[model samples]
Target: MTPSTWSPAQPPAWFEQARHLAAVRRYQLAEELTRRELAQNPRSPLAFVVLSMLLWQQARYDEAEAAARDALAVQPTYDEAFYFLALSCASQGRSAEARAAIHTAIELDPASAKYYALRSRFELEWHYAAQSRATAEEGLRVEPTNLECLHRRLLALRQLSETSLAEETARNMLALDPECAPAHLALGELLLSQADYVTAEAYFRAALRQQPGLAAARQGLSESWKQRYWLSRRLARLDAWVARAGQWLTARGLGGHLVLLLGFVLVVPVVCLPLCLAYGWSYLRWRLAPAILLVRGRPLGQPCWQCWYRLICPAWRWPWGCWRPTASGARYGASRRPNQSAIT
Candidate 1:
């Protein structure tokens, strides 16, 4: 079976009991097994690595990092140990350290698709969409059937707003694995971006059917429902029509629109000039009237020009605060999508 579809019953024989315990989230028992293995063979890198994974499963990142380091000390060339160390560091928000460790892991085992996918995820988190896509593409080159790499590439393209390319990639993913939940969710998000609420909703529903507990798919479904409401749907249709009209006009060249704008400007000047004149007169009267109240015809404190400047040029600010944008925290369950190579 492929790595993504790994079953708990699969036999590696060496760490059979430990792996089974960890798979079932029995981290305490898994730790005991690893401890026994280490007692039997103190210099065994695999035992230390298992201990690291068990600690990682319990969110004990610092302890996990130490265990991974111990594994590396026992076997300097342990790529999987380095991979787990990177994951532990990343979970603790030490991104720079995490990136460095992940890079070292990749350098040691460039053929491992999981390393490349993790690197891509880091790049994307750092807002390096192009680099993320390149890394995922490299992973795909190494393992053409790797679903995680494909999904990472799709996500990177979406971040870059390369919608057409993202759509093609999503379609390719579905072709590779029709039952893949992430592929369905990716397609749903792509369609949602294009304002195809009806189709997007269907894709999200399909994803939910495949993986009922998928957080991202459920969040996508909620957003699709919000967009599919009657008023939002009507507004979306109008927006689409306007977009089509704009495209048609552009295809015909800019001259037509320029002529239309010219006509509007000419007509507005005639109607607006008199009103402007009247308003200007009233403003002058108001300002002079204020000055008349000043002693010895001296002007008031200030012209209040600052008020006008503020009105003309409002303060620069974002609608939201300076926080990184994120999806509705759609985390795949830790148990279902085990970070096997990277941590487990």
Candidate 2:
């Protein structure tokens, strides 16, 4: 068809509804509505962009990329098309293309903090911590109250080990949003690293109070307690070792024992104490650590490690009893007889 003959088809009301739904973050319903609309007008760029966003939200990156390409082919300069194209490319490890597309988006809308935020996100995805921090900082300079910009800056600072800056940014974020769980968790981790156990515990507790399922905050709290416990134990052990060495020096009449005692009390605790404490900490973690996940506030009954391993390396269920249970009424009964279990 000639370019003049390429009349853009009018999208149905359902297509508009789907766009609204996607805008409001109701992705599943948007996907269904977009599918229905696409059935009627398959070549509509609007339809394709909506479908692309839905697939992107669901993390179907390859499908999202194809849909974005379809939209871009119909309307090459469409901003939303380019935006979703960048997202799909980023999701699938096409960082160079994603970066170029994001740059184009920013060029198209230089004043948009959302575009800068996307740039920061792509930098983070590529593990360019310093570049991500700069991008986020620039975005925040333009839009001072932008939550995404502040969050990105905080995360990048944390990753780069810029402790003071990260803590400051996290505190600012918390001041803006007291219920921000990640900010609280980040501040807690920073304090924990600095050996500020009491303050770290308070931050972690606050995070848990806001979001009980925040595993990072819970982990920070656990680590803070372990640190204090280990420090106390190490000091006690060093004192005992020193007392024993002093008695040895008195009995053997050797001045070397005093030196040895000093070395053991000072150097050994400096070096060996951390290692010993780490081992004990890990032992306690293995023994008393809570389950990594919970369902309805109860510990997950299924063995996640075994399930994850099975998922990674699939094997015939008939050869091994590795069938998983379903929440539905389908009972996955154990295979009693030989070759009775169906392969998953």
Best by TM-score: 1
Each candidate structure's TM-score, on Cα atoms with residue i matched to residue i, is 0.63, 0.58
List candidate 2 segments past 4 Å from native: 1-27, 40-44, 209-212, 231-344
Task: Give lDDT: candidate 2, residue 69.
Answer: 92
Model 1, span 14-62: residue lDDT tens: 5887777776777798788789878989998877877887788788999
Give each model's whole-structure lDDT. 0.79, 0.76
Error of 2 at 311 (Å): 76
Q: What's the residue-level lDDT of 293 in candidate 2? A: 18
Model 2 gets an lDDT of 0.76
Which ten residues in a row are the worst by lDDT in model 2?
Answer: 290-299
RMSD of each: 27.4, 28.6
Residue pairs whose backbone atoms clash in candidate 1: none
